[model samples]
Target chain A: MVFVVVLLTTMLLCICIGSVNIPLKNTLTAMWNTLWGLELPAGVSKNIILNVRLPRVINVALVGAALSLCGAAMQGLLRNPLADGSTLGVSSGASLGAVISLAFGVSIPGLEYAGTMIMAMLFAFLSLLLILSLAYVLDRSMSTNSIILIGVIFSMFTSSAMNLIITFADDHARSIAFWTMGSLSGTNYTQSAILLGTLLICGGIILRYARELNAFAVGEDNARHIGVNVKLVKLVILITVSVMIGVCVSISGTISFVGLVMPHMTRMIVGPNHKRLLASSMFSGAIFLLLADLVARTLLSPIELSIGVVTSLVGAVAFIIIFYRTRKAR
Target chain B: MLKAENVTVRYGDHTIVDHLSFHLQEGQWLMLAGPNGAGKSTLIHAVSQGAPYTGSITLADKDIRRYKPAHLAQKIGVLAQKNNVGYSYTVEEVVGLGRYAHSRGFLAGKDDDGEARVENALALTGLTELRKSNVLTLSGGELQRTFLAQVFAQDPEILILDEPANHLDLVYQKHIFSLIHEWLKIPGRAVLSVVHDLSLAKKYGTHAVLMNNGKCVSQGNINDVLTPQNLQAVYDMDVYSWMREMLGQWE
Candidate 1:
């Protein structure tokens, strides 16, 4: 309940603090007007708040929630504190897919604008399939360590492949690099709707298994002993998380640390019960990313920093603190 | 209530539990007694369906594999030797997980009956006072008791345990065994445990299977299977003299 309020407040604050600073009062009025289909009050720039910042903030919030939820689920499913979407090569695969589309001018007919996103989502799932297959072959049990190892190796391989592609495609190199660093500069309502839809569907699926995830905390065999079909649960969770991460990466590029840090931070407060942890992580992630995005754009007036840079810079420091505190607590 | 017919569990080319057979009758406490590598744990794992095995292990005459994971859980509960809890879950929360098979739907909220069972389990394991405590902060005995509480909450007809008290003080061992003994007194309930302590087995087990190198050397009545000669044959040591010598230290 508090999270909802804080999230809304943060969204409104973010919308008001961009390059063209809008007053909080006017921002509230604009939001109210938009909500009831009323015309914007005088002195309010409808274009800036409604069109420009609203969707951008919404996208940032959705991406943050999606990434954090996946991180929490992955950590529980794999029973590894270090597990996240990136730990399984999904982010790198999305990056590789996006880079391919950009460099080779690959655009879907009648949906040219969505080609990169489509390809990104496609390759993200493909990478998960590849990693799981390899892990299965290596260890029929598909142990968590083997899956993580394969994912790390697959990430490196795809990153190298992406680099090679970038080196040859000089014209699209800058755009590819920028996209990889992530940005919410030109996001519109359509992408926000898509991201919201994905977050809802995937987040719902992940939330449905909170109890199974709790059962997993005691170990896979223990979970199995308690009636969880460990193999099926793993497959379902990984696929659902992959789709969520794929869509987020396709829309916003690979925003690091949100997936890794938010859950850890939330766990400290919510105490590792997925029933609360997963949902709390979503709100915490949304808040953190909204603030990070705010700092990214406004930290340097007229020269926006990449949102990914701000997140990594902030997330890394926060993560170190969390690690040290947890170690000390232990 | 539970029976194993020539169950064989293999890892790659190495067979761990080779053609082992055992049956557990309701109201009986069956102990798997063996040395470290005698396949006792493997057999328990095979019975719990945690490991792949060739032969049929049945619960109530149904092949174990044929039951759905959740359905099987309703019939059998397992308490492993060491439970690795990586996260900080409260004792009550951990015990509540035992109700998973009974709960229905995607968002399986704890029903009133589940809450009652969890409370009963906590009380049964003497962890009711520590219900809110984080399991990670628990002592070895307490941790073992926490898992024992979980299995108790599961309310299965058959309980498979791998070293229920492996590294606890004498008091914890007694507490755990006594709890199991009390639980087994209920009708239609049985327990299969892998025990390293022959004295505990002798005291608590109604039936015993003595194994070495994945093959059962002796079986049937606990006292008959644990004869000094059988112990010496499997352990290659004068077991009765060593036990008497250890008892002299107490005197």
Candidate 2:
């Protein structure tokens, strides 16, 4: 109840407190009028709320929820509390794909506007497969350290590849650099819809495996002993999470630490059961990003800091606090 | 009955268990005794169908590999020496995981029968008091007993345990052995255990396999396998003299 209330309130604030500063009553009234299919009043309020702010807020919400849930799943699947969406190089791989499509003007046949999205999703899956196969080849040990190390190496390679693409580009270098910093300014209803649909489908698949994830939290061997198809669970979770992160990054450009921070925060409140943790983190993440985006837009007033900058700043501080608290308590 | 016929297990190019064969009949408790690296745990892994091997393991006339994970888990349960769950769960939640094979949805089956078994296991393991405590806060012995309760709740037809008493106090260790002894008395249940305590093995093990360098040095009744001569041959020590000295010290 608290989470729902806080998330709704944060969404309201995010919609109301942008550069033009629409009143709360007008914001609510405009949303209601839009919902009931009535024509919005012809004013700056309608244009700002409907065209500018609502899509951005919805996009942030969807991306936040997807990333958080993916983080919870990865943590459970890998049996590592520190594992998150970015831990597997999904973000970097997606960024690389996005950079390639942007720099080379690549376009797929039916996905003109979503060419970058398609590429990002493809590369995200490819990176996961690469990590798994690399680990399998290197002594068949999917130990936590090896997975993390492999993910780091993939991130380095992708980032360097992205850099190479940027260097060769004469006209698109600035645009590619800005996109890599992650902003929600370009979102439209179409992009938001894609993110929302992906979150629903992938979230359903992930929730179905909650029990298996709980068993996996004990250890892979324990998960297998308790009748979970460890291999299947691992594959399903990795694919689902990669898809989620890919879609999120494609839409929002690699917003960092919502996955890592939101789940840890929710776990402190809801305990470690994945079922509850998953839901709580979804709500917490949505609220967290909504607030961060609000600050990103209005804190400097028209300068418009990148959403990734704000999230990383907040996420790093939060992670340090959590790490310190846990250490001190222990 | 669970039977392994010429089961050969290998890691890379090195063989761990070489052409080993054993029969574990219902209602029998067999002890696997060996030095630190004698491949006892690897053999357990092979029999539980958790690892790849050359030969066959059969339970109740069905090939072990043919059983799905859930079905196989219902037929056999294993308790390892240590368990590491990345997140902290309540003791009851951890114990209830044993019913994962029988469960259909989240948080185990929660049927009356499953709940009753979990309760019984917790009581037997003396973990009823800690049922609500986070497993992360548990002492080593407490964690060990908690997993024992988990295996008990699994209610498998066969139990395979690797050093189940590793971190227990003397009283709990004796209690755990007695509980295993009692569980083995059931008509269609059996136990395969790896234990380092020779006195306890001699007292409770109905049959035994003595291993050295992955080969069985002796196999048969407990007395024959645990004879001082066989013990010395396998361990390269004066077993009778060491036992006498230890017994004197205990007195």
Candidate 3:
């Protein structure tokens, strides 16, 4: 109940507080009028709320939920508390794809308008496949530790490749840097709808596996002994979370900390039960991102910070505190 | 009955468990005794129907492999030697997971009967007081008993345990063995355990298999197979005096 209230309250506040500080009453009135196709006293207010801020808020919320769900699932599947959506190198691979598209002017045949996003998603899947194949070759089985180690190596490779792209594009360096920093600008209602659709579909499937995930947390052999098909669950979770992370990165350009931070916070609050953790994380994630974006919009007033900057600042502090507590307790 | 014939477990070019055969009747307590690297644990893993192997195992006249994993779980419960959890699940939650095969949904939200089974298992294992405590804080003996409770909650026809008493103190070891013995009073229930203590094995084991270097050194009634000569041959040590000393302690 608290999560819902916080989410709805923050969502409304985000819609009202961008560059122009419209009062909450006017914000809701403008939204209702614009949505219902009724006349409004301030046409500009309607335009700003409907066109400029609504999609951004909705997009950030969707990305936040998707990333957090992905993080929780990844951590459960891998049996690592610190694992997140990027454990498979999705962010670095997507960044490399985005840089390639931006620097080389690459365009897909029918997706020229969405060439960068398409490329990002494509490379994210490709990097995941590479890591799986590498793990198979090295261990003759897809062990979780092997995949994590190979993903780290792939992340390093992609990061260097991104640097190479930046160095070559002297005039486009600033554009590439801004893209890597992450943003929620230029989203439309259609894009937000697509993200929402993905979140509902993927999140529902992940929730259905909550029992198997709980079994896995006890250890894979133990889960299998209790009747879970360990290999199949691992494969399904890996692919589903990778796809969710891929789509989220393509849309939001690597919002760094929502995935890693939200799940941990939700876990601390709800205990380690994945059934409760998955849902609470989604709600908390939406609230976190919406609030982060609101701060990004209002903190400097007209000089908007990247949403990623605000999230990382908060996430880094949380990470340090958690680390200290866990270490000291141990 | 649980039966295995010509079972062989191999890893790469090495044969961990050579062609082995055995049959366990219901209500029997079978003990597996062997020196290190004798493939006792490997044999247990292979017969549980999960590990890769070249073998044929049957439970109640049906091929073990043919049963769906969930259905197989209902018939056979395995208690592994080591239990390592990634998350700090409460003791109750860990024990409750044994009902996964019988559970209708993902969360193992047990019905009344299932909840009763969990409660009974917790009571049997003396873990009711620690039900809410995190498993990570449990002592070694407590953790062992917790896993035992999980296996008990499974309510399988057969229980395969590896080193069931390894971390337990003497009193709890006797307590757990007595519980297993009492559990065997139910019809169509059996236990297969790997034990290291000769005195305990002689007391609780009705049937026994002694192995060395992946080959069965002796197999028959527990008293017959655990003879001093067989123990000496397998362990490469003088066991006649040791056996007498152990038996004297029991007396």
Candidate that scores best on DockQ: 1
The lDDT for every candidate, in the order shown, is: 0.90, 0.86, 0.86
TM-score of predicted chain A against the true chain A, for each candidate: 0.97, 0.94, 0.95
Model 2 scores a C-alpha lDDT of: 0.86
Q: What does candidate 2's lDDT look like per residue over B138-172, in tens digits?
A: 99999999888988999999999988889999999
List pairs with backbone clashes in candidate 3.
none
Q: Name the regions of candidate 2 deviating beyond 4 angstroms.
A: A39-44, A108-112, A139-146, B105-110
Off by over 4 Å in 3: A108-113, B104-112, B243-251
Per-residue CA lDDT of model 3 for B81-167, tens digit only, reads 998888889999999999888984646564658899999999999999999999999999999999999999988889999999979
Best candidate, lDDT: 1
Docking class of 3: medium
TM-score: which is higher, 2 or 3?
2
Root-mean-square deviation of each candidate, in angstroms?
1.5, 1.9, 2.5
lDDT of 3 at A279: 89
TM-score of 2: 0.96
Q: Which ten residues in a row have the lowest lDDT in candidate 1 chain A?
A: A105-114
Query: How would you encode candidate 1's per-residue C-alpha lDDT over A1-54 as one tens digit per residue?
Result: 998999999998999898999999998898888899998767888888888999
DockQ of each: 0.88, 0.81, 0.78
| Per-candidate TM-score against the hidden true structure | 0.97, 0.96, 0.94
Model 1 CA lDDT for position A126 = 93
